[model samples]
Target: MTLQTSLDDDAAWQAVLARDRHFDGRFVTGVLSTGIYCRPSCPARHPARANVRFFVDGAAARAAGLRACRRCLPDDVARDERAVLDAIAAIRGSDEPLALAALATQSGYSPAHFQRLFTRNTGLSPAAYARALRSERAHTALSAADRVTDAVYDAGYSGPSRFYAAMKGRTGMEPSVWRRGGEGMTIHWAVMPCSLGDLLVAVTAKGVCRLSFNETAADLAKRFPNATLHAATAGTSDMFNRALAGVEAPATAAQVPIDVRGTAFQELVWKALSAIPPGETRSYAQIAASIGRPKAVRAVGSACGANQVAVLIPCHRAMRTDGTLGGYAYGLDIKSALLDKERKA
Candidate 1:
């Protein structure tokens, strides 16, 4: 199938300038002067704009007589992303964790080589992925099982203690609270002015469940629709203030707890966003590729749009494949200012 994206040459050029990884497989850059093609995220010194021609894929670049870039290895990267995706599917579908040797055999890669490739592509080792899968199953089971013990067993854990430990480590909440959708939850929220604009933060006992810009308590009510919402008391907890400060100065945002929720793929996308260093940026394509779903660029964008935590999760770091700013839930101006601040810091 042909590699495709909506980006035009001018947009693609911007991605090249930013070394945006999201556009890596969406398009290739053919340098007229060097007769070589590279992925958009190539770290080599960029060629002059006039000397670069964009192609939908390396085949097109090769047809134009350009040799593939040794640095980016675009084709190999795509294949690796696809292979990791297949491995993830197998892991998620299996009742038990597949052995590393078995997974390597299925992917036609040597054990050592496959482990490295899988980690490089997904930012997760196979074992880590399996653990995450079990955690997700346990969380789902908790929501429907008649008893916590039943849920633990149903999620494939041999022991309830293992499930309890994992849940505490991941969510820092009681299983009953998680399963009941924030029942008996007291969420303190306040809207405050900041560099970006109006910042709204809602915190559960577990962590920050919602942090957004230009939204109101009414919006929060709609989001939780069920949980109690209160203005920050005369003196909120230090953790609440730290979360607020994190939004005000994202570059220095402390790693406070977060209770944000989403589907597995959405969570993966958010995790990738949070890992982007301050002042750095990535395209949706790069995020999708990082999650081993290169073809899910559009889905990645949707996940970004659905993000509720704002600067804490750093959703603003996600940009257009062309390095241009894309949509933001608040506004483009706010997004631009946020990026500028991070870059200056």
Candidate 2:
């Protein structure tokens, strides 16, 4: 089927007229009458079909000199602002025992009120968001070859026990095991071109592990600086080929292997992302609260941003608190398309 076939052109145009957040970023509707293109979910009046054209991506619309719609601020939405600020705050205040009550107090709201408002605005509470931020920092540090203990302490985890517990809860494996980097285990991976650019699929002995895009082999190496990576052509490994095929289509009962290495919190966030069913979405704040940290809305946004794995981990399922489509490492266009596809499914 064609890309446009997937879009309910008439309904999409109506959604544009209504400025539906649900359709935001899904596709661009170009108005031949006004010489402008807009997100399908843009809130604008309907124009005649003769005056309407559609593009699969923003770049195509922009390349034609049709500006984005002003209503949805198609070009300006990003989830990173919250994530960045939260990360900075976590880094600066690592020595303190940051709590929900403390964050609520600082925000001038009671913990309950703060929780509601924060989740509404950023999709995560204060504490959970902060924990994710700390976890990300710890993961980056460890990925850079820092000792596990040193990275944990540096990330502000109070002690080894707490860090270990958090790690196991999130990753279903120990940090040491993750660091070993699929040593004796075999990982199956495939490279393919995709809508967003190039795609990379890596699976371990357990489940679908890593799906990344727009990165060269060199880039992948840098991302997993400490892990050993190998090139796998078709026919080299049945498991690897199976993983590639499975990711392209839905399947059941296949245990794909994963060689994931990250701080406890990031692993947790990623695991949560994976749990999101295809065709469903969760706000970033909801993800944070689900993990028992309700104060880390911003941090949850960061974890979503930091995610390296694509569809299989389902970072695309995350949305802004106001139901806005947010940033994706690949691009907002891809994020919108992925969500749209899932919604249709």
Candidate 3:
């Protein structure tokens, strides 16, 4: 691509090299050799640096006497977006998981290609997305229904057995336990100090169930009234240490397993938040778009607010669309400090 004027030209070039879809629509890439411009994330072969330029937008590129490329159609994001939305609707409306090949064919692309496109845009594989839909539906139903059997059946499960089998990992606990708010589970929690104040890490057998700031055993007691809460013993296990590592140094910390609950959309928002690197941030709209629900920007903010575990999920990495840090549950001061810490790391 030919060089062009930009305040952060080097950063734009890096985004091009990475094919960073996050930069799509922010600018258009103009190729002098081909005399056509494309989106920054165009899968088309990169032109030589001397042959390319960047424009503020597609109109700017067109004004510069460049046409749009066909492959990555820099101006036709809506077409691919429609295909993605249609597929998502189908997935949510289905009682059973749609086959990848079938969904791809319906979207007018090969299965392999469609899989990549779908995942790249939505940050989830088709099957995984379907599973999330199923789990979410089941959970919603369970919350309102008196009987688990009826709830599962109503949620489109063939039987209670199948529902349990399918929701083995998606849920924080068994259907009954979850519905009863940890009726039969045991949670151990400990309060410790960190760069932030008063870190509370609660764990179950599976993993950390909750992590937050300025919480005590009494706080844990209130949150899990139905469960048994124990203070950490003198010999806290390696799992507890791992959870602390996640809180103290999340950027390089090993993957810390979390056994927590969330709604379907919240789970998607959380997954997108986790995908963000330590030093980088994503706008709430960007997170919503990554999950193929760009219109749910406000809901994304709600999900961030609803986060039970802090730092590990990195809700602080999300900001308002205008690049300002939005509200945080703890406080803005803590959030700003966490961002600064990560960036420095």
Candidate 4:
């Protein structure tokens, strides 16, 4: 089927003029005057509207005696795919971290330019991606290995100090604790009715580990399977009460300690979200920029969605770049109500 089967001719022409990547691959832009065709997102100067015709694919354009443009290489879908894959393979193969310049060089791209390209395509900078790969490897080793020290080194960490530094606040548990799937940890949990829904509050002795809406002990069991999940009697932990209060009136909620866990980048995102004033809001782009990763806006949104503790970190304060409520785990209605409550306060 042709693009005309789905996209109208005028819509396809508008896409060419806008250089929209969303339209690329659905059709080719054939210029009758120059006998050249390009992907919809091609950067070449726009041809006269009368000279342009849309084709279903490169083969269709070639059949009409049109050659593909050299710049965008409309026919070579695997060109950039191979580069991204090769860089990923290089990062995973080496025991040590690869430098940005080195990885960009291997891909025949300039360091600064490739940095943006890699981040845009992967939703992570090359360095962050490498850390994530190493961290995943470390998690696997730590979960099975008998000795923490041996597991750290086995995961390609330079030393225990670096491993601890890398994993600091990542799992919110000591290395030994993660090794046993929270074997030694005791999590006190309770489900309490709240303004929005039933709130699940689970805490370690150190701080509140989770605060979510409509979740239960069953959900808590999945996170800390081996750990003892004690059903706390009412008035058990003052911290849990404080957390419940926070869920109701976030502005006046006491500062309760948090024991949530996430990646290094995710931690940065959470920190930025927490810094947002209750009545105020920040765009996803602003949050990404606050953490010194301006191009990581999409990554910031993913981190927000991954957040387990609601209202405490205040992911609800995050908005779209266009000044709209993007989404919330609970619902847009809840997000709007929270913002309204904050604004009224």
Best by lDDT: 3
Q: Could you tell me the TM-score of candidate 2?
A: 0.47
Cα lDDT listed for each candidate: 0.81, 0.61, 0.82, 0.79
Worst 10 residues of 1 by lDDT: 1-10
Name the lDDT value of residue 75 in candidate 1: 75
Can you list the residue pairs that collide in candidate 3? 1-51, 1-52, 2-51, 2-52, 2-53
Per residue, candidate 3 scores C-alpha lDDT tens digits across 1-345 of: 233433256767777897878777667888989899988899988889888888887788888899999998888665566677889999988878799989988889889988987887777888888877888888888889998888998888888888999887766578977888779888888888887888899888878888999978888888889998888875556777887777678764438888877877888888888888887888887788787887898999999998888988899999986568989999999999989888888
Residue 261, candidate 1: Cα error in Å is 3.2
Query: If ranked by TM-score, best first, what sequence of candidates would result?
Result: 3, 1, 4, 2
> Stretches of candidate 2 above 4 Å error?
1-189, 194-197, 203-209, 233-236, 250-255
Q: What are the per-residue Cα lDDT tens digits for candidate 1 across 75-178?
A: 77567667788899999888887999999998888999999988766667899778877877887898889888899889988797887877786764677777
TM-score-best of 3 and 4:
3
- Candidate 2 local lDDT, 44-63, one digit each (tens): 66778778877766677777
Per-residue CA lDDT of model 4 for 173-274, tens digit only, reads 678778777778888999989878788988887778888888879989997788888998665668778998887777754387887766656766887777
- Candidate 3: list runs displaced more than 4 Å: 1-18, 31-34, 42-60, 70-73, 234-236
Candidate 1: lDDT of 103?
A: 91
